[model samples]
Target: MSDDRRLKVLSAIVTDYVRTREPVGSRALVERYRLGVSPATIRNDMATLEDEGYIHQPHTSAGRVPTEKGYRRFVDEVARIKPLSAPERAAINALLSGAVDLEQVVARTVRALAQLTGQLAVVEYPSLRRTTLRHLELVALGPTRLLMVIITDTGRVEQRTVGLSGRGPDGLVDPAVLERLRLRLNTALVGRRAVEVVPVLAALAEQAPADERAVLAAVTDELIAALRPDAEERIVVAGTANLARSLDFTAIGTLLDAVEEQVVLLRLFTSEDAAHRDDADDTGTTVRIGSEIHEDALAEASVVSAAYGPGDAVAHLGVIGPTRMDYPATMAAVRAVARYLSRFLTGTEGSTPG
Candidate 1:
């Protein structure tokens, strides 16, 4: 069969099946798509496509639907990614316009993606490991209590309160003393990894007088806990209501719980290191179709994800939706949101969540 004719038939079947969520028969193809071919010729092409594993039928009497291979080809060759419509652009603008900070902006962006695509939306927080320290604040809350506040280059702020058994001289260790400690810590840790701060913990402890040694130890422990990676990758998800409203309700019902959704999302974003080639530090957007992720539950799901940060810092942002989702529109929305979020996290804009 001619390649041109095969493409036309493939396009017809994909378009029809996507619209009706039903199989495409030769008669339906000829009637609707009108490829200027007799039923017999189209049947022959269908047979070839089925033999090539690009299309499949539920049974002998059923029509054909595009297989995963067929869908991949369609995504690569046929689908045209386009920007949101004027009304949609306005809605997105309105939704994101009032975000007071990066956290709110990211939450709003996730909601917008889900609303626009009618699928589950996920947006990952910027990874803390890739961010440098913007500020380190030490507050002496009480005789035996201390508070360590860590501000990252991405404008993420984390504070941990530490309690010590031994009390220090209260009036002698006021805001001025705390600021002196903060300046020393920041000088040593400003551009380094949070983990790298471990070596200096001992030094900071020695800097304090004997009476305040215990208090210093407590603050160091709190700072370490706040900087850990497990505390960093926490994701925010929204618009799960769209999943409940899907026409394929039964197929997704068992997986609609928050725990299950989080698991599915983590698996989708964690790429095998082998798959990443040049510039391992670069942030990016990726889309995966059915069966590509090697999971049965997600076989019918399409994932649109992105990594956001400084060019050297890698982090993820994006959404997951049904395979029949508006691919072009969803892709455009995901890409745009991811780009904007990267800017927000990097402090290019004067916005950070409250």
Candidate 2:
């Protein structure tokens, strides 16, 4: 069989099934799409495709639906991401510009992606690994307790209240001493990335007065844990209701469980394939269908994701839907959103929040 002609028939089946949400027939394929071949030829091609495990018939009387193998071929060999329309670019610019914080930026991106692609949208929080400390504040909550607030350049704020001064709550901290230590920490740790802060924290702890070393050590330990490479990253997801609308979702309960777990979704975005060496369009976007996801809960779903950053992927944005999704359109929206977010983060397009 000619690979090109068979692939053309498979592509038409995928496109029609995605649009109509029904098994597609060879007659419909010939009438709607310009296969330029006779129905008998299309039928022969489809039979060959099915024999090769590319398409399947759920019922003996019904037409065929693209199987996972079929969708994989279409995605890998046939689909080209549609270019964003001028209006789409304009809308993205208007909606994403003027965000004031990282949370808002992520939320807007997720919701926009959900709306654009009509799928469940997930956007990973800007990883602290790539961000610098903009400021660090220490506030006394009690004589032996303090609240530590970490502010990153990306506008993420993490706060922790710790009373681990080692001497226990009975041994009160001097107000003046706490104030001095706060100033010293901010002076040394501010303007440094997570990787750069580790050594600086160790030095600060090492040089501290004997009485203060324990407190500084505790603080540094917490910060180090927060910056650990294995830290569980957070992701924001919207359009869960989109899944409810689909009768075709195979394991709605389990898929919802996976969404709540988020670890599975995070791995999906931060997988080995997501990181790219350069900003080429082909290498940056990932399309995972069915068992390709390797998650049983997502066995009947398709995910389109793209990493967005200055160059290497500091974070990822993705759309999740049933296998019968508009691959080209979803890929286009995911890639476009990723590009706009990359520009925003690098201070090239949207104003960076302070």
Candidate 3:
């Protein structure tokens, strides 16, 4: 049989199996799809597909199901991600428009993706190591205390308090010195990655005047600690009930456990080789089906992920469901949500929180 005709038959089998959750028989393929071929030819194609390990029969005298390799090929060769309708786009905008902060935006994104795809959604928080500084502020709260706020380009804000010494007779930080430090820190730190900001701050403190040196050093210490990367990254998950309905009862427990463990999920996203690199689109949307995902617990599940920030990936968001999912629809939803998230983080979408 010709490769093109064989692939066409395999595509039909995958589509039918995904939609009805049943193995596809040669007769059913002939009846349902316009293959322009006889049932005998279709049966021959099915036999060839089985020989190639693309489809397999689960029981005696039953139709065939697509294997992982078949699904991978179907996604790469036949699947075209469906575009969102006008109404669907409008609904996403309405749902995500009200988010006022990074946390709220992430929460809304996960919910929207889950609802759109009918699958469990996961959104990773922006990584401090990957995000650049947007702004920094210093405020005096009392005679011996100051507040340092660090904001990133991704709109994540972190704050820390610094205790001061060498106050004036009135027991207040000198306004002139505070203003100078703020200007210098902003000039040096803004647009730099969080991991690179600390050393710059320390250098700035060393060059400060004797009277302001202590305050600058204290603030530097606190800011460095605040910007340091956490041992484990954070992720927000929603729509776990969708998993219960779609996956086998025996596999749901392990899948949920893996989702609950942030470390495991983070590995799922960053498992460098696991991601399907489609150079066709610049969005970096990846699809991992069945065994492509290295985690033993998620062996039967599919993960559709996309990075959502400026430049390279600052964080990832995606959905998890059974391997027999609607790849076109799910990939489209994941891509759309990630694009909106990138816009929101870059101040191109809605108003960001104060």
Candidate 4:
């Protein structure tokens, strides 16, 4: 058989198996795909494929199934990623437009992607280490208590209340001192990564007047603490139940264990090495099929991840499903959602979620 014919036969087998969740035979491929080849010719191609390790016979009498290698080839060469329909695009906009806060946007995005692709979706929280400060506010709540709020470019807001050790003559945090410190903080922090803003804040506090130094120190400490990396990176996951629907009991248990383990999920989402090596156009999607995934638990699954944010600063979001998933539709949904999410985060598409 010609090499092109063999590849076509392989593609047909992969598509049929994905749709029916069953092994595929040469006769079935000819019948279902109109491959214009005799059963004898197709069987020869199947034999070649099996011999090359692209497919395997699960049983002596059963038809062939695509191996991990075959699935990888199908995704990279055969699958034509379909574009989202108008209604699907509309649905995503409707579901995400209502979010008024960063948390709600994340929650909505995760749910929407899960429902769109029928797979477990994971979205990483916009990292403070990657986001620039948007604004800062300080409010006096009492004679010695002041509230400090830090806002990031991604619409994340973190607030902390600091107590002033030394108060003004009027027994309140002096308004003049507070205003000067606020201006200084903004001057040093605005448009800078939250994690990198610490040293600037420390320098500002050190230069403040003696009477105001105590309050400045307290405020600076709170700001840095708020921006410090959490003990575990935050990720929002949805559609875990979909795994039960598609995977067997044993497979489901193992997959769930991997998902619930934050470290494993984090490594899956944050592909620092892949990110550095990715020289594809900015919009290209990342696909890891079966063994391409480093985690043993995910050996039976595929990951479709994309970075979403303005310019180069981004957070990862995507779905995990069995390797037999519909690659075209899943990839399109992942890419489209990432586009919407990037727009929403950068304030180019809709209002920030409340």
Candidate 5:
């Protein structure tokens, strides 16, 4: 048979095996799919495919299943990621249309991606290092107590409280004093990165009161902790429950352990330094199957991922499912939801939070 015929036969076998979760035999392939070939001819083709190391036989009585290489070829060549159907698109829009803030959008996006794909979903929020300072708040707890709160442009909240050197009544340090302090802090740091707050702290010491000065110093320390690169803010995962029903125990155990090792997940999503790479398209999603995934735990699994952001700073969203996952449908759902999340995060396409 020609190579074209062999590939068609291979496609049929893979599609059938995926749908049924069973090994495929040439006889069954000929009987089920309209491949325009006899069972003997397909058997010969299957032999060739297996010789090429694309498919494997699990047991003496069983038929052939697609190997990791086979799944990769099918995903890259035979599979076409279908666009979201009208109803599916409408449902996603309806679910996300009422989001009140970035947090709501992130939560809804993860849940919707999970429900649509029937897989575990992972969504990474914007790294604090990538966000700009939007606003600052300071409240006096007493003559000796103060509270500092910092809000980032990407909507992350950071706060700290400090006890000052001198004692006085809390009510005496009113909103006016707080506002004055806020103005001074913002004047030096507004629209700059969260990582840049420390130097500004040193500058404020010359102008602030000894008591208020101590409070601001504490505020700077808190901001640095919040925005540090390794902060525990890389990824949020949902739909672990979905994994229970679909994946076998061995595979689930490996995947669960991998998830607990956040470093592994971070390396999977971001580059070595955990910075978003330039080559990754903000609009397009990446899909890795079987051996294409770096870790052994994911060898039998497939991952679909996308990045979102404003300029250089971005976050990642991804789905993990069995290698037999419905590729075209899952890819479409993941792509659409990732696009919606990009819009929600950057305010480029969706309504602003009320």
Candidate 6:
């Protein structure tokens, strides 16, 4: 019973300190919370908690604040993330709906998360290696020019226009020939991963008729260009102004610089915390508090992120903020955004509840 009560005391201290941004005193906790303990008992519980390294007194005769260890314990102990209300879910769905392209979806997501959570938000682009081709489209712009459209399973669409004038002396590509090549490319490449499509494309080119050779070569070159980068090579960030509103932060300069670097922020989303992906207890959210983030710039900040993508292709998105932020509420917002984003990419809207 004392253990449970002490945990309650610790939880109350964290809650109050996060709200007030000041040391939490036993008296303040007793008045603000329903811990159902006497003042002396609360004080004793606080003392024991401090001794356990879960909390600290910042100055002589000051109230207590949770240490990073304490925040970790509190986060681990949370039984339920605060759920998004119906309107919030609607808002997220509305924001993400009708995004015609992958870039639009990512842009809307960052805006939605930053607006919802009032924190810096980031969404990393899906890695090409993990994405599969859903379709290959060839549209004849002119007799000797065609627009090549590559659609990935993750809803990433890349388009490039190629000239076939060298092959078309009369500046005319036979419509029948273009259609045949499109069909052949789709048959050989669709549903295959980016890595798996190269050899198949090369094989198609090797056996191609003279007229189709230029188009196939163009296809091969463009496809390789599209998929050559690392996972999350492009990340979109929003809400730096949210960080500007914070008054107590000491590492703001380094953190802002890291945000600009973008590659450095990947540690919070993909690299260092890669193995900690949750079992999708709703949205596979991962929370990194303070030192857990492993970046000196973010040592005083926290990151709450989730793996978000369509089907087997996954990328990451999250909010970056001071450790004093609301974990449950922020987690819910991140989860909601990620879930909606995955739905948008996969085109399976109603299969999962938001």
Q: Could you tell which candidate, 3 or 4, scores higher by TM-score?
A: 4
For candidate 1, list the clashing residue pairs, or say none: 101-352, 101-353, 102-353
Candidate 3 lDDT over residue span 1-354, tens digit each = 248988999999999998999889998998899999999999999999999888999997899999888888898888888888877788789879978899999999999999999999999888777888888899999998999888888898777789997676678998888888888888998999877887787788778888688788888778777666653567899998899898433578888887776666878765532353542244467888777777888888888888888776788899989988999989888998988898898778753211
The better-scoring model by TM-score among 5 and 6 is: 6
Candidate 3 overall Cα lDDT vs. reference? 0.83
Candidate 2 lDDT tens digits, 1-354: 358999999999999999998899988997899988899999999889999999999999889999988888898889998887877777776778778767777888998898888899999877878778878887767766778898876677888776665654566666666777888998998878888998898788779987677778777877887788887778999999998898788679899888888878877766634233332346478887888778788899988888777654677788889999999888888888888787777667653211
Model 1: per-residue Cα lDDT over 110-183, one tens digit each: 88777777778887665566567878888777766677787887767676787766553544355555666667
Candidate 6 lDDT by residue in tens digits, 7-35: 88888988898789889998898789998
Which runs in model 4 stand beyond 4 Å of their true positions? 140-146, 161-172, 228-232, 272-276, 279-282, 350-354
Identify the leading candidate in terms of lDDT: 3
lDDT of 4 by residue, 256-305 (tens): 98788767788876664375357223446778877778888888888888
Lowest lDDT 10-mer window, candidate 6? 272-281
In model 1, the runs with Cα more than 4 Å from the true position are: 1-4, 31-39, 170-174, 199-213, 258-261, 270-283, 346-354
lDDT of each: 0.70, 0.81, 0.83, 0.81, 0.74, 0.80
TM-score per candidate, in order? Answer: 0.82, 0.88, 0.87, 0.88, 0.83, 0.86
Cα error, residue 183 of model 6, in Å, equals: 2.8
lDDT of 2 at 141: 79
Better of 4 and 5 by lDDT: 4
Which pairs of residues collide in candidate 6? none
What clash count does candidate 3 reach? 0
> Looking at candidate 4, what is the lDDT of residue 72?
79
